[model samples]
Target: MTHLKVGDKAPDFSALDEQGNRVSLSDYKGKKLVVFFYPKASTPGCTAEACNLNDNYQRFQSLGYEIIGVSADSAKRQANFKTKYGFQYPLLADEDKAVIEAFGVWGPKKFMGKEYDGIHRTTFIIDENAVITDVISKVKTKAHSEQILGD
Candidate 1:
């Protein structure tokens, strides 16, 4: 699948949240969205990214944006991560990689000279109408929320 570009309609998906509650992309219609795809739950980079978003979550809400994190982690892992970090947003469990693949975030990756398929740290800013406004591909985990909010 091609990487989604600005002006592309954000792909709609439904997934289970950390608490096993159903979440759908369409559920947030008429609100801007920050749909972030990370490699795993509780990993250093992922945690940093998630925490950055959590820290600035109120600001995001003030700006009329709903934040969501997605990964191939199980619901239990996502629940633990959210509780440990006190995250206010939902972390969707994409254990089947369906949502990740639809967003073009699941692909080959290399670490320590070993190539494997995994989620690429990426963020999509979608408008109220579901059109993607920006694609943040090379995300800096520590300053992620700042970058997303254009700080």
Candidate 2:
């Protein structure tokens, strides 16, 4: 559900992470970045995806990639989720959705035959120069690390 595609320049964003620390796209200059947007914190699918990335944190680190998760959850909720799961990366508490909308990941979604507006689960792999190298719209939560690292 993202309008962004491979080779598109990643939209710039400056938002607060779980700890209320300011995070911005500029912070990751000269580094490969994985920005994964999830529907909610602590949900089944989101948990699996976040944990999968956490489990492979070292791999990403060794390969010079930094991971960040984004959701519309409150800072408290994001902090709780991170602490509970021991995630090694930052989880953006984008309650304002500035980053979400900038990336175009929020839109109509369906579940259990019900339709509503929500954040679409998506991952964008960006190279050091800020160009998107890949956009994983159909995320495989259980194998997300492989999806990003499967060169």
Candidate 3:
């Protein structure tokens, strides 16, 4: 599947959030969304990115945006990550990779000369109408939320 681009309808998906609640993209309709995909739950870079989002969460809320993080981790792990990092947003469990595949963030990646398939750190900003407004495929962990907010 091709990666989603700006102006395209953001693919709708439903997944179990950290709290075991069923959350769907359509549920957030009429509201802007920042949907981010990360590689793992508790890794350094992922944690940093999530924390940055947590820190700027109020700013995002003030801008009328809801933020969600997606990863291949289980709901339990996601809950732990959120609790450990004090993240105020929902972290969706994409153990089946359905949501990740739909967003085209699940793919092969190389690290330290090793090739593996995983979630590529990426973020998508969707407008209230569900049209994608911006995509950040190459994310810098520490500045992720800032970049998204800027866009």
Candidate 4:
């Protein structure tokens, strides 16, 4: 969904989290970041993906990486999803697609033979310097952490 690749400078973005608190790329300055873009909150695939990350949250943290999930869901929806799943990371409510567009994950997708515009399930692993080190375009929802950590 995105043309971005490893070694590309990650684009900066600012958006609201589930609590309406502002979140920006700058907040993660000096830390590695894992920014995963999903289509929605609370859906089966999305839940599996998020839970996978949550289950392995500490591993990423131990490796000096902070994870953030982004979707076009409303703040209320994001909050509910986080609360329901006990996610260890904040879910960004990018209702306006600012962060989504900035990352180039908002585009057409096909599922069950139906085509529609939505956020692509892509994950970008950015270094502390804000340069992308890996771009996971074909995300494996249930085993995403292993995919990211390569373990």
Top candidate, metric lDDT: 2
Q: How far is candidate 2 from the true structure (C-alpha RMSD, Å)?
A: 0.7
C-alpha TM-scores of all predictions:
0.97, 0.98, 0.96, 0.98
Candidate scoring better on lDDT of 1 and 4: 4
Residue 130, model 3, lDDT: 94
C-alpha-based local distance difference test score of model 1:
0.93
Top-TM-score structure, candidate number: 2
lDDT of 2 at 42: 99
lDDT against the true structure, per candidate, is 0.93, 0.97, 0.91, 0.95
Instruction: Rank candidates, TM-score, best first.
Output: 2, 4, 1, 3
Q: Per-residue alpha-carbon lDDT of model 1 for 1-151, expressed as tens digits?
A: 2379999999999999999999998999999999999988999999999999999999999999999999999999999999999999999999998899899988788999999988888999999999999999989999998898888
Stretches of candidate 4 above 4 Å error? Answer: none
Could you list the CA RMSD of all candidates, in the order they appear? Answer: 1.0, 0.7, 1.3, 0.7
Where is model 1 more than 4 Å wrong at Cα? none
The alpha-carbon deviation from the true structure for residue 64 of candidate 1, after best TM-score superposition, in angstroms, is 0.4
Model 3 C-alpha lDDT per residue in residues 83-148, reported as the tens digit of each score: 988998999998999999999987788999999988888899999999999999888899987698
Write one digit per residue (lDDT tens) for candidate 4, span 11-74. 9999999998999999999999999999989999999999999999999999999999999999
